[model samples]
Target chain A: EPEVTQTPSHQVTQMGQEVILRCVPISNHLYFYWYRQILGQKVEFLVSFYNNEISEKSEIFDDQFSVERPDGSNFTLKIRSTKLEDSAMYFCATSQGVYNSPLHFGNGTRLTVT
Target chain B: GENVGLHLPTLSVQEGDNSIINCAYSNSASDYFIWYKQESGKGPQFIIDIRSNMDKRQGQRVTVLLNKTVKHLSLQIAATQPGDSAVYFCAESPSGGSQGNLIFGKGTKLSVKP
Candidate 1:
């Protein structure tokens, strides 16, 4: 079974610095998503991408956040200026389709902003 | 506002006992639902999923029951084992959105005691 791979399983960044989380999705997947879970909180949706464009995004995906599939393979999430509130486990998910398909998730990157 | 939530925060059961976790959703129009399991340092892994057209679906040792009438969902694990200990989350697609825009519940932590 293929799996979505994320880099730097743990990341620690200082406040006001930039950070970019990377994910290598399954080669055949067409849809990609980013979700984050704060300590002892529910997972929250941040953004979704398809066909080289952002399909939908949540209010939490503010102007400071951006996503790109720059090489048509690797998906990345960039935060312009990290804040303490940004500390959480960031997960990258991919699916072959959008409707009934289950999203396959990566192990996740734990980002800690201080 | 759309909200998906679990009824319990934690459940403890004997290794050989069965476990049942419950979830409630406020969106009646949600047609797709999924149950995911997350271990300590991993992302959510798909356990089972059901569509509005089905009332119950079963896999290896897991069963998912959907009660659309009451807007509820449940996951039952038979002969629970220590390996089954994890946080389980139920998620649903927003009423007017695709599955990529899943809204996850608060999650229920299951603990199996040997």
Candidate 2:
């Protein structure tokens, strides 16, 4: 079974700095998504990417957040200025098709903003 | 087993028992629903999903029941084993919206003891 792979399994960054979380989605999958879970909170949707553009984003995906599929296989989430609240485990998921198709997730990148 | 600091609602069950974790979704327009299992230090793993047209769907050791009338979902695990201990989450995705943009509920931690 092909799986999503994330880079820098864990990151520790200083507040006010920037960090980019990388994900390599399944080769044949088309749609990609980014979600985050604060230490004790529910997993929250941040953004969805398809066709090399952002399809939709949540309120949490504000000015500081941006997603880019720089290459055919890599999907990256960049936070311009990290805040303490931004510390969370970020997950990348991809799906073969939209409706009812299973979303394959990566092991997640733990971002610790201090 | 491992434990996460999320302090989620927990259900303790003995091995070989049936465990059901419930969720109430906030979106009535969501046509796709999924259940995910997350162990400590790992990402959410797909378990099963149910579509709007169907009320029930089953997988290897799990079943998902959807009640659109009340916007509710439940994941039932049969003959639970100690390895089944993990946090379970239910996510919803609207049909007409961006395809895989999901909204997840707070997870319920299920612990199985021998």
Candidate 3:
């Protein structure tokens, strides 16, 4: 089965520094998404990308957060300035562009903002 | 105010027992629902999904039931094993949004005892 792949399974960044998390979604998948789960908490949607543009984003995806499908297959999430509270497990997922399609998620990138 | 939520934050079951996780959604227009399982350090894995048109769908040892009238969703796992211990989340997507954009519920941690 095809799987989404995220780089740097773990990353530790200093506060106020910029960090870009990279993901390679399934090759044929057209919709990409980013979600985060704080330790022992619920997973929260960050943003969804389709057609090279953001389709939807949650309030948590503020000015400091941005997403890009830099290449046809590489979906990336960049945080302009990391905060201590930004420490969490960031997951990248992808799905076919059909309604009700199930998302395939990557193992996740553990971002530790110190 | 669209939101998906679980009935309980945690559940405990014996290895051979059946485990049921429940969820509720406030969106009457939500037509697609999915259940995902997340182990301690991994991303959410798709377990099962049900559309509003179907009341029940089964896969392997897992089953998903959707009640559109009541805006409820449930996942059932039979003969649970130690590997089944994980946080289970239910997510919903309203029609007309990005096909894969989902609103996740606060997950329920399932503990299976051997």
- In Å, residue A11's CA in model 1 sits off its true spot by 1.0
TM-score of chain A of each: 0.98, 0.97, 0.98
Candidate 2 Cα outliers beyond 4 Å, as residue runs: B1-5
By summed lDDT, which 10 consecutive residues of candidate 1 chain B come out lowest?
Answer: B1-10
Choose the strongest candidate by TM-score: 2
Mark the regions of model 1 whose C-alpha exceeds 4 Å error after superposition: B1-8
lDDT of 3 by residue, B46-98 (tens): 99988888999999999999988888899999999999998888999987766
Residue-wise C-alpha lDDT for candidate 2, range B1-114, written one tens digit per residue: 123566779999999999999999998888889999998888899898888999999899898999999998999999999999989989998878787888888889888999
Model 1 residue B77 lDDT?
100
Cα shift from native, residue B108, model 2 (Å):
0.6
lDDT of 3 by residue, A15-109 (tens): 99999999998889989999987775667888998899999998999999999877677899999999999998899999987778899899999
What lDDT does each candidate get? 0.90, 0.89, 0.87
lDDT tens readout by residue for model 2, A1-114: 899999889999999999999999998999999988888888888988889998899999999999998867789999999999998899999998745688888999999999
lDDT per residue for candidate 1 within A2-113, as digits (tens), equals 9999988999999999999999999999999999988767888999999898999999999999999999889999999999999988999999985789998999999999
Q: What is the lDDT of residue A84 in candidate 1?
A: 98
Interface DockQ of each model: 0.44, 0.61, 0.44
Best by DockQ: 2
Q: Order the candidates by lDDT, highest first — what do you get?
A: 1, 2, 3
